[model samples]
Target: MKNDLERAFEEARRRDAIELEWLGASIQGRPTFAEAELLDRRGIPSCHVWKIPRNEAPVHLTAIDALRRWQAGACAMCSASPRRLLVDHCHRTGLVRGLLCTSCNTAEGLQSAPSFVAYRERPPAVILGVEEMYGSPWGEEIAPSDASPEERTQRNAAHVDAAEGLFAGITDRFRPECADG
Candidate 1:
């Protein structure tokens, strides 16, 4: 039997094909060079492609579906518009991490791969709250731009603690043992 992730990948590919095919068809007869280039570059197979570190590249549909359900079509990194988002995965394990916009994806690619992998493995619970503000604890006034270094550090530490608490809550409630009760 196929595993849950495999099943999700299959279902997402089937659904995303329709959208991709539409994109392909829309550029079929355009005279602009950009349009034709888009068609040639994307084709059908490449349009939804998500490359892993390995030779096999997965389609973008599964990650897209997960994001749609969990994040209301917002980019995980910047919470920007969901347009042209791509799947971010671990190259070593090919694990689907999250949906990121092109810029965010590039930014992430520059960071340490292990950090991204760790974040993806046990995603923070705050990720579930897409509408909530993500970043530092001090929203606007806690630390002004000119705040002393010590003040900023304190605020950052507090934010980290709060984030850890949120993740702990999610892990405690959703752990396998807890689920059986």
Candidate 2:
């Protein structure tokens, strides 16, 4: 009974051969060429062509499924095979702490906390209204000039204030509850 299901899963994986990673960002997205090469060299075992993680890696599931799993508060660390069941960072940062199991994260922590920490902290975390941010999606953008310190500080302050105002009014845009009563 189970063998047939396992066989089918493997067959599907083989069919999806072009993509080595389906669950998260591809190797190219790793911070630097050195980083990508490092991950490649280390050999991400669970992402092997033939073997699937013992407990399924929820890479391709729809939002509803992911949400359900998240709301249920499933253990961030794998309950079954701790090593394979790591809570992989969606962004591989400490602040985001989205996917991986506890053990894998701890293992990586020994290597460098910043790399892991960056995963948990979402990029462009600054919320400027529901639609826009003062900073670009990648965060800080250099204007390509050696502007004076005073000028730079003033520009930054204005940007931050604009972003705050944008986000602040976001709540009002969605639910205008104050007027009813």
- Candidate that scores best on lDDT: 1
- Assess candidate 2 and give its TM-score to the true structure: 0.22
Best by TM-score: 1
Task: Give the lowest summed-lDDT range of ten residues in model 1.
Answer: 44-53
**TM-scores, in order shown?**
0.31, 0.22
**lDDT comparing candidate 1 with the true structure:** 0.46
Sliding window of 10 residues with minimal summed lDDT for model 2: 124-133
Query: lDDT at 45 for candidate 2?
Result: 21
Q: Where is model 2 more than 4 Å wrong at Cα?
A: 1-113, 116-144, 171-181
Across 1-181, the per-residue lDDT of candidate 2 in tens digits comes to 5699899998778745523343223222223334433443454222221112223324554333332233123222222223233333222111122334465456655644443333333211111001111223446532212546565556556655776798876766567674455
What count of clashes does model 2 give? 23
Instruction: Please give the RMSD of candidate 2 to the true structure.
Output: 16.3
Among residues 3 or more apart in sequence or in different chains, the pairs in candidate 1 whose N, CA or C atoms overlap within 3 Å are none
RMSD of 1: 18.1
